[model samples]
Target chain A: MGSETESARRLLTGWGRTAPSAAEVIRPATTEALVSALSRRPARGVIARGLGRSYGDVAQNGGGTVLDMTGLDAIHAFDPDQGTITVAAGCSLAALLDRVVAAGWFLPVTPGTRFVTVGGAIACDVHGKNHHRDGSFGEHVTALTLLTASGDMLDLTPEGTPDEFWATVGGLGLTGIVISATIQLLRVDSSAIRVDTERTADLAETFAKLRASDDTYRYSVAWLDCAAAGRLGRGIAIQGDHATRDEVDSVPPVPGLKPRISSPRWLSLAPILRSPAISILNEVHFRRARTAAGQIEAIEPFFYPLDAVGDWNRMYGRGGFLQYQFVVPLDREDVVHTALELLHRERIRSTLAVLKRFGPGSRAPLSFPMLGWTLALDIALPAPRAARVLAAIDEHVAESGGRVYLAKDSRLRQELVDVMNPRLPEWNTVRRRLDPDGVFQQDLARRLGLTGASP
Target chain B: MNDAFGLPSRIVVLGGGSEIGQAIVAAIVAEKPADVVLAGRTPVTLPDVPAARSLERIEFDATATESHGAFFDSLFAAGDVDLVVLAFGVVGEQAVAEQDPAAAVEIAMTNYVGAVSSLTHVSTRLAAQGHGTIVVLSSVAGQKARRSNSVYGSSKAGLDAFTEGLQLASLGTGVGVIHVRPGFVKTKMTANLKAAPFATTAEAVATAVVAELGKGNRTVWVPAILRPVMWLIRAMPPRVLRSL
Candidate 1:
């Protein structure tokens, strides 16, 4: 405890590098230190940050204290027979997967980037391509420990404390600080994925294919070429599952976890991407992908292709970029079409657009996913005109009983909080009960009115 | 905190009663800045915008350079201020000022000396906080002195240079400084004078300032065409410029 010193302030932003803020970041290497640090609540309060994978301000607290949990990253125990792993909250999913896959186990749910920590995974209740079949990361958790604002450590489980567990699962780190968690791991034969790819001519075909064949595949997602105006919704549907030993002719070494090369920080392809050249580039990509089946690929490329290029966010330029990801109920598929048409009409091009079908949402009130169609896109900043289009989309989403994922948001209006997530009141009640003084807070919580009122 | 689109949530206008300052605040009313501080010599009435969460007035005299340090310290100590607008200046009539040295000095003191003093304190406070931007309202008259308004123009010239230098000094401090040069804005300052070429209204200047801030631009021209117009005007030799 005596070793701890006053940490210097750091300017932090999410993976998207937008809306950065300054906070005094303290790295607590032990649970005892983390708890002690939380006990002294600064005026602006404290929030925990992992690898800063969240796209916006979810992990930031301007003029506040940010607990850097990466220090307490020890994987305490692993049970092969029962397929359970107990690890500190600061342990990153990349570290956990490397260890588990070598032992014939896999993460039940993984987001696009494996750079996220266990604490962030539970805080956002992240969903993966296999969400329709396996559910979110929080659904697989067996037990967890939370350090409440009152300095009380809680041992929570789904069965033992449903209210506290569900609330903390997707609470956006507003309820309390998650110290450590015990997760249930899935068994896999190899660290390879058996993938099937197909090209869809337009939005209709892509939707039809995903709706028809999504059930057969354990994991499925579609990448849309939005710049292709001729075939507006043109895309490629990718589906895959963990490969069995019999399915693989020969097993290759596990792919490297760290990115080998990084995109130049000064390089900005935004101007070119915003021009007609985007249409040609996306068309070439669409034409290059051929219909193929039974292709064995490494897990790294299959799960996190962008992770191959570190600091890829810099490609959008210094102004940074925004990832607008939203989920609309399955019946409101027209909203997705409306969004694409609006972007085309406005002459705004999305560098990368992804479409997926989500299963039923979890018990957590603020959880973003539900039985719906979700579209995520990357748009460069300084496109102030994009704000109007997004606000209109937010209205449509809220009206359809859908909502934008707070994890990937930076520009959402505060008024839409209740309309989008009706369960917010319920979540806030539990959050307030846990931290009556609201000692745990963040920029996202304040920006979106996540906790209702500031402490 | 800035919104997802980079619209600042907390805004401060040093020259609170300045027409251009209020116009800029009014322009961003739709975004709903949480806190708006209007500090000037006199009590300033709230703008027409009712969507703002809180609007407060504090007494700040630009001529009172000695009190600026304490004034800014208490303001920033309250909380993090996202945007600061240094919009206090006087446009003295050159004809009346050439005969009266005291009047010329008054213009110089208010426009140049006052700005340097206030900005020094504002910049220090914002830099220490690690996040915030200061927008200084300069004038196109500062581009080159006209015999018609030499006193006012020269004062603005000093401010323009200081603001740009402060921008460089602010590098790596996480604080931003933007220079806003408006050609001719129609407000109380120019109400009795003839409208200049491409003369704009205070509302127009506000619109451009807010939009440029959103784009994270270091400098902006009110009408935008003035950028090219000023370039050509600057190319003429002093011998040819003396005819005006």
Candidate 2:
């Protein structure tokens, strides 16, 4: 049965497809329907779900009402001259990317998945490959239209309603149900990227390369080869900037040349899910010479390579997988070294890890990254000493003034959360003030006691 | 074409409308952005296939073998084709085949002679281009002719033999030919048949073919165990096999 229904109970999970919870799901096709659903929330409370791409419990509400935002996917207004688009929160970034990329404008910031909703990007303040230059997704948002717990509709902005705006940004969707928003898009001459790649010997060299030359490139990421026996963090450091129209002049006019309208469908990783298979893949990947100068590539391949495989989580077997991403300040790169060493010592098998360097954070108090190195590792679920390994990493992340991304995290606790983000009390105060009746709540909020529910 | 990434940069599918052809194309494109060309008689659409950086369609009729040479010449004139998937054929009803020998010849020609003509031109282009993979779709039915449908089985038998010969010739020439022998694939052609032993989905075969492509192997048997099973089937007494 379809999960977008108001009357029927539907079980829902995030992109990780783990820890599913049943909820009363209602698709709000119009603002009236959304407001009506919010006004009459059930005992378990209500949360808004958009594309269900949050990776954790953020989009689910057990025994509660979940507003499936996809029904509201529509372009309310578009101005090519101004390079801005006003769209419903439920509209997927994938659907909107087609129109923007064709027009030679792009989203200022996008996470790994383009299938997520614009509202989810704002709620999580999601960062992307260009975070070092552009910052988080919320920074590009011009305005947000929200439905509060008291049945009130409020318009907020970074400059106009700075408090409410920052709170709602990375506020974990606790402030209210996001109805719609105005977003500013970046201008580009073409959809191609001019990429430069170099393989690093170890963690030290990789960190040095990223720290020294990251500012030169609009996008930069390091694919950490965790499977390499002695060279733990050895991998490739890729940097790229959107290719200018002139840069692609060498590419002869191919008849079918056009910007990719959507990301590639998911490819299953089941065939190569075993550790041996992954190790071989990683070894093959790591031996691609030393460096490649520059090549013109499309945006999707540069930004979202894994999007090609559908249901990639299936590769982890039926037990599912967890993506543990944490960010520490620029000075504490050693904490990252310690964490990887710990994983190696534990004999925990993880494929190539993804590492990104963040520039500066935004006004959002609960924003995950803050001028540091963010490392993300995917581990098989039911792994050996899974809890102990993650807990150890979490302790180091917190102790080193680092914090885990709430959207990407599924195992953080309450007190450690406060330690990670000292501004949690302030965010909680703002959340309580905006949703005093606690009508806006979901599984994530309940799990971490963010909305006063005991964990 | 992708010397650095190992993901094929340009792929050409001979029978875009065939379920097996689309599956192989989908698998290759999933690895990375590869310019894909779909050539078929009908307009083919690959649903759920990831967004292609560039996807082109050409009207192609396999029965029109005269155009095979010029088609390959132009397709490979400007760029190298990394992989060519051959999955075009017709399996006519056995009753119609028995009633009219002309209808039976039409099916046989379309499945065997037409495929050979097209593949010959492809092999020449790939050989000159220096490197590429050619995937030919054969079936288990070709392993042992059945009483119910000997015409289709014989046609597949010819295809299997021809592709294997081509594979042997292309060795060390940088041209790879992958002969895929699957048992009872649940495609439109096999929809009417009852659930056969070891029946497989088009996607299951697609996955297996894509995995084998990585190993740079010449032949792949779907369900894998079919390799040993086909061995036993080939060794089975003709009387006992006919009775089954």
Candidate 3:
């Protein structure tokens, strides 16, 4: 057994703050060891983490041991005929994408960042731009291996253990330790994206174009300028889908097509993140988007722009930042405009503001996306006055029948959570049955009362 | 003092003037425990400890064992006492203890026997409730009987062992016992002791304990490395262990 160390007790709560404490952190190398360790001491609460990408406390359990699942990453099996791959929970989506794309197969869905673990994706029920066309990553999952509180390993799927399986899909690691999973992969023609990029003058124009053009494309997303008021939500909208080999010949060859190249590490640092610097950069970026032109672009550049900057999260400074992502129904498009108008009126300087239209809801009850338009903003923390502004926005979202993404939430109040996601109680019930001892608990759980278990 | 579960949790610290106890209470208060009770023999003389608005105070005496049961029963009858922090004990000179056995016995009973009786009553109620956490303050000196302070160390050792056994027996039933083994802390109790290596302040210990409580830890050694140090000490021969 490895000795618990203070250095291992550090965690990056969704707000990007490294909360340090003294804990007996245990990194189990194998599923057997993980089960034995859990059965032996039965941690008061345990949270599983991989690459620490979560913007909030979903992966952080104060004072409790965090099961760092990254070490358990290992590709187990691949069935070419079925286009399915089975891998340990800790295997990164980036690694899988690289390998799968080489074989003409691609992940059915991927979040903006490819560095997240499969288990992390399932836990958060992550959605991508294509969510309007396809569903969440949970929809592509075929089966999972779960280590329950009783130290029993259960293989679950939609058919076998439907309730437990669906619960675990978006259960946020509260159900059990996900050891491995078999996921069905989508076949693609090439590694290129057939893209059409356009810039709109304001919120109205952007919404009009998105609603009209989204049906023609498999992937659609927009970057809104939250800092702009009367013409709030004005920004660029990009739409794309997998390109066939024939389409690439008519367009200029895309640059930097490989996925393995490491993005420059210093781009996210404070030296470039200052408000004035960001504003200047945004102006240049807006000027570059002159027309609705089609281009052949590398999939890496199209989906994961930030991936080009390694460790980009560090750019937010030591205090870290909060990634506030909330969605409103299609009918509440006016609310989205109002939200943007408020941000612009407040002159709140956000680093990045993304808008996407969600296609449909998944089987997971608490999954984030639905038939709505989602807007996500990244704001730096320690903004003493920003909390009030965010609370105002939260009220707007709740009134509009929208909810904030739990995976990205850090500073939201418990009261807001209770009202936003009415399914929380049902999710808690399923969670309690799997982890009867309340072993899988975290700061998020404690704050939001996710675990019905006391204290 | 609420149990680990924080249900029916009502903690009352007898040493209202103790900095260590006050810090522990402050940490416990953050858990949103049902209630907190601060008490002392001379409750009127005791200075106000920073407490949650939900916390209350009353008169308590460690030596008054005759009324201890009834006093606890009344509190329980009002509500359940999930946890009780027995943070009332004395630290005195080894020379004084050796010269006067009566004074030594009083100190020993207050630190050990008195704590045992009170904790036993609280533990029984918690066991009935089927969930709780008891935070007991034990000292690192109890890792081994020290020539400098064997009497006090022995008392802590007895309390530590009892708490460990209690924790073990309560397992599977939801009741938890946390044995807090802090090194020399700059509390009112250790104000006269020479500053030692790795000594922490009461607030630091309190913070560590609170963090550990959230994690549902059974045993915690402040400056955590002491757990290994204690293990090494236990593995050493008697002659070597004593000399060290």
Indicate which candidate wins on lDDT: 1
Task: Please name the candidate that would achieve the greatest TM-score relative to the true structure.
Answer: 1
- What is candidate 3's CAPRI-style docking category based on DockQ? incorrect
Writing each residue's lDDT as its tens digit, candidate 3 over B1-244 gives 2211222235667666677888887766554433567777777766554545355667887777777898778776664354567788777788889899997898788888878887888777755543456788888878887777888888899888888888777654445577899888887677778866678888888877666442233688887888898888778899886775
Model 3 quality (TM-score): 0.66
Candidate 3, residues A395-427, lDDT tens digits: the string is 899988889888777656445776788787887
lDDT of 2 at B192: 86
lDDT (C-alpha, whole model) for all candidates = 0.84, 0.77, 0.73
Of 1 and 3, the candidate ahead on lDDT is: 1
Those runs of model 3 whose alpha carbons end farther than 4 Å from true positions after fitting are A1-8, A11-15, A18-22, A249-271, A453-455, B1-244
lDDT of 3 at B81: 51
Predicted candidate 1 versus true structure: per-residue lDDT over A182-270, tens digit per residue = 99999988879999999999999999999999999989999999998778888999999889998888774554657767877456544
| Candidate 2 lDDT tens digits, B1-244 | 3211123557888888888888888866654446788888865453334645578888787889888788888887645576788988887887789889998998888889889998899887765544567889988878888877778889999999998899888764556678899888888877887766888888988877766552233588887889999899889999889878
Ranking by TM-score: 1, 3, 2
| Global fold similarity of model 2 (TM-score) | 0.63
Candidate 1 residue-wise lDDT, B183-230, digit = tens: 889998888888889899889988787776633338888889999998
lDDT of 3 at A38: 74
- Give candidate 2 misplaced runs (Cα > 4 Å): A1-6, A249-271, B1-244
